[model samples]
Target chain A: MTVLDEIETCIPALRRYAHALLRDREGAEDLVQDCLERAVARRTLWRGDGPVRAWLFRILLNRFRDVRRSAEGRAQLVPLDATVEPARSGGQEAHLDLREVHAAMGRLPFDQRAALLLVALEGMSLAEAARVLDIPEGTLTSRLARARETLRRMTGRAPAQDLVERK
Target chain B: MSDNLPIDDEALIRLRHGEPADREKLADLLAADPSLRERLAEWDRQDAALATLYNPLADEPVPARHQDLLAAAARAPGWRFRWPERIAAAMAFLAIGTVAGWFAALHQMPGPAEADLATEAMRAYATYSVEVLHPVEVPASAASHLESWLSKRVGRPITPPDLSGNGFRLLGGRVLPDSQGTAALMLYENDLGQRLALYVAPAPAGVETAFRFAQSGAAQGFWWVDNRLGCALVGDLPHDALRKLSLSAYDQIDQT
Candidate 1:
């Protein structure tokens, strides 16, 4: 496939991933568009050493981090209630609800959430996800384990017998 | 059957994703342990929940804007020359020569090498001031953060002078990549929407601190080297007005 075609195919996945990260549909789309423009403009920089998909994700993530840092400067402008996901309450539930899982995902640290999404939502392999995140595979694995453990606890899916281990 | 398993989290994660190299060993363990099976199922459920939440976004038709962008990019020639960026760069180089020559003629002194820094500022001002969308990487509203960030990158404590008294409010600032380490450009705008920029970079040690003036096209600049910092104050305003702002800006930035 041409580089543009490869990039085109990744757009939907990019949109999904951006939406998951930003939790704002319009903002996510804008971010994806910006990322696509950048990737195209700098297409010459894309060495055939890695999958174009990973490079695109890396660009999107870098853009996301820039937007986030700028957002941090104007923190008061963001409504606290709107951004904070409500913690899922109550004891162990037998099934995980999508909304609950999403809110729990939001509560995950950015690193952990990013790792989890690459592995789970995008179905990228551990090594591929690590490349996208620019982290060691062992670090990504640990983040995933921590993310799942946190998700289970927040969604009240932690096995009853496992409660004693919880501090 | 206990929560403890011989496999590490990495092996278990691989198994849950069905990429385990030792499938036979894991399968035997799963057969002996319902808990391990349950754990794998839980991972499956979590992935399913995430997929349910986000997959529809992918399934939805691609937005027109995205499709349009891809199409436009595809239509572009492989070896395209971006005229706007090229024009800006050419104008900058021209400004450098014009300013350097002016310093040589008007001052009766050999053109200071720092005049190039002045025109670099002019170039930055010309390029970014016309930018409607992203004139500055960090907006002026984040003044404190912008200051500290630029200061760290430029390797000099930079305080963007308050120019409100001179009918200009700070618009924002950005760190510029320079051949000599880095420079910081702080943009300011007047009520008429005219912009002025202050470019600051670390000067070479023992450099003369002579103040200088240079102009190119509609843009004029007043620049100087003081206390190991090279600074240029650039704008399209007339000579006297731009000179006035530059002196005060020099004073304010010099104190830092």
Candidate 2:
């Protein structure tokens, strides 16, 4: 496929990943736009060794980091209430539960959230996610475990007995 | 079945590798553990919500403006030209100069070199102009220091040209290398959010030049080579405004 076609195919996934990271629709779309532009500009430099999706994710992550770092002092956390919309299905309780999950996601440290999203949301293999994150596979597993624990506690869910049994 | 949890790192590896037996063991362990079930459920919900949250963006049409920007970038003169092709083309053209008609043909062909330079200059301007943090190597606030530093690097006694009369305040200056050689780029901006870039590089010996104007996309550029230096002024301003800026910059730099 042409570079532009490959980029177009990846946009949906990129948007999904960015939205999870930022928790704001506009912010996520803007980050995707920037990532696409950078990738298009540097297409000649792209070596086809790694999966293009992984490379695109790496670029999106880097751009997000740069934006966050530069906005560090002035950054404001988006309130959970602001992120939820009126449910088209009229299931207010389910919507509220979703909002709680999102807020819990926001409370986790960035790395853990990134790991969970890559594994659970994006369905990337542990090895591919590790490569995208520039971390060892073992580290990824441990982070995923910690993230799962934090998320369960935040959501008021019981600790999984598998974890206790393993310990 | 207690060992089904894959607690040992090796068993965990087997499970990750999608070994069927290990997968069943892991699933059974999660099924037997309430806490594990809750945690897994939470992860599943989070994933579902995220998938739904960003689904709209996929169908939301890519902006026509952004597509136009990409198209223009693709059509840019130097986009497909590798360094070797550029050098070879330059050499071939120069060699063809031995034939009278070929030399004239070479002179008549628009090289697009100036347009490429202008594009680079405007891109650099746009990138640095909007930055609230770390705008330039030297801020225009310290005009003297910026001038001296850039001048030392470019091997010219440079000064930030006074553009107060033209409503543009000197923003700052930086040194950038182009195909021609190392050049000095000075940035300027007005209150109206318009930015201008002036690039000066030493001219080859005895190459007398004339003022030339060219446009690329939204930007207009004016270029000339004086006895000592080749200079270009680039911006999105109208032709008259760009010409006026170029003249003002030339007058100031010449006096120095």
Candidate 3:
């Protein structure tokens, strides 16, 4: 497949991750669009040695951080913890307490939330996630640990698990 | 249950995978430790919940804005401003202005407020003009949803501004959030495949509406803030070519 086509396949995942992080569908779409613009703009800077999805994820994250920092220009603080509705699904999936999960997520610091989302939601390997976040694998592990602990404490339920997560 | 072995991330991973060796060890060490198994089940359920929450976005249709961004990046030489082409554009603008009175305004630099609106309009143009597949969230066919959704989000009544008289067709719009409340980006396309975007955001309270225009390397735009909204019309067409189109859109919005 062509590069743009490959990028399209990753778009949904990018949107999901962005929405989960930003908790705004429109903002997440804009974030994903910006990420696509940068990837297609600077595709040359990205070495093919690594996964393109990872690179796109990296850019989306950096752009998100840039917006966050600029918005926090020491004036009116934009609340990053806006209440979010988790993915809306029907039927058998109705049992999931998405609101509870979303509320728990709102309380997490950005780093831990990001780490947890990458590992659990996106199923990234520890090494891959570490590379994406520009942190060491050990640090990524500790972040996950802290995130899980925090979620457990806040939710008063079995913490969100990273099922089938790889090392 | 026997050994009170502490569970680390590594141990949890093994248990999650149900590695036979770990299972056998668990069988021997803590024969009835249902707690570990129960924890694993929670993790599985949470993972499933997240998968359900986020996995569906991929199925949602791709927007025209994203497709255009991808195509434009692929078509461009680079993301940097093309200075030589821009100089050529200046020459062309003068040539066109001599023939059509409207091009003269294209040469003027944008004021601060107009500059902000123009840049957003340019962004809207870059995001929607080149799209083919899904260029709109609510297509023109479903004008009511498009209208109501945009109106609600933008905190103002919005009728899809008409441009058929100017040869551009409505392709619908999406609401974008801003510091104040929200902004509406409505897209239009002429027969030649040139797309235009009409972006509407509320002006800071107390700002009155006026007819204003601005231009940049990417696209030239005309913007005004009525007592209720700050409106901009953007497209890749030269300013002279877009004047009639912009005016037509303004007229429709004025009625609104």
Q: Mind giving the per-residue lDDT tens digits that candidate 2 earns over A72-118?
A: 57975543422322222212123225665677788778888888788
Q: Candidate 2, TM-score vs. the true structure?
A: 0.49
Each candidate's lDDT (Cα)?
0.76, 0.65, 0.67
Against the true structure, what is model 3's DockQ? 0.15
Which tens-of-lDDT digit does each residue in B146-256 have in candidate 1?
989999999989878766546788889999976567999999998688999898887777664445777889998988876778899999999878866875676566446
User: How high is each candidate's TM-score?
Assistant: 0.55, 0.49, 0.48
Model 1 TM: 0.55
Model 3 vs. true fold: TM: 0.48
lDDT of 2: 0.65
Q: What is the lDDT of residue A57 in candidate 3?
A: 90
Candidate 3 residue-wise lDDT at A146:
69
Q: Report fnat for all candidates as fractions from 0 to 1.
A: 0.51, 0.18, 0.32
Q: Which stretches of candidate 2 lie over 4 Å from their true place?
A: A76-96, A160-167, B2-42, B73-77, B80-256
Clashes of 1: 0
- The better candidate by TM-score, 1 or 2, is 1
Consecutive 10-residue window with the lowest summed lDDT within model 1 chain A:
A76-85
Predicted candidate 3 versus true structure: per-residue lDDT over B42-149, tens digit per residue: 566666766777778766877889877777655667423242344334335544655134433433333466447667767777877677887778887666678888
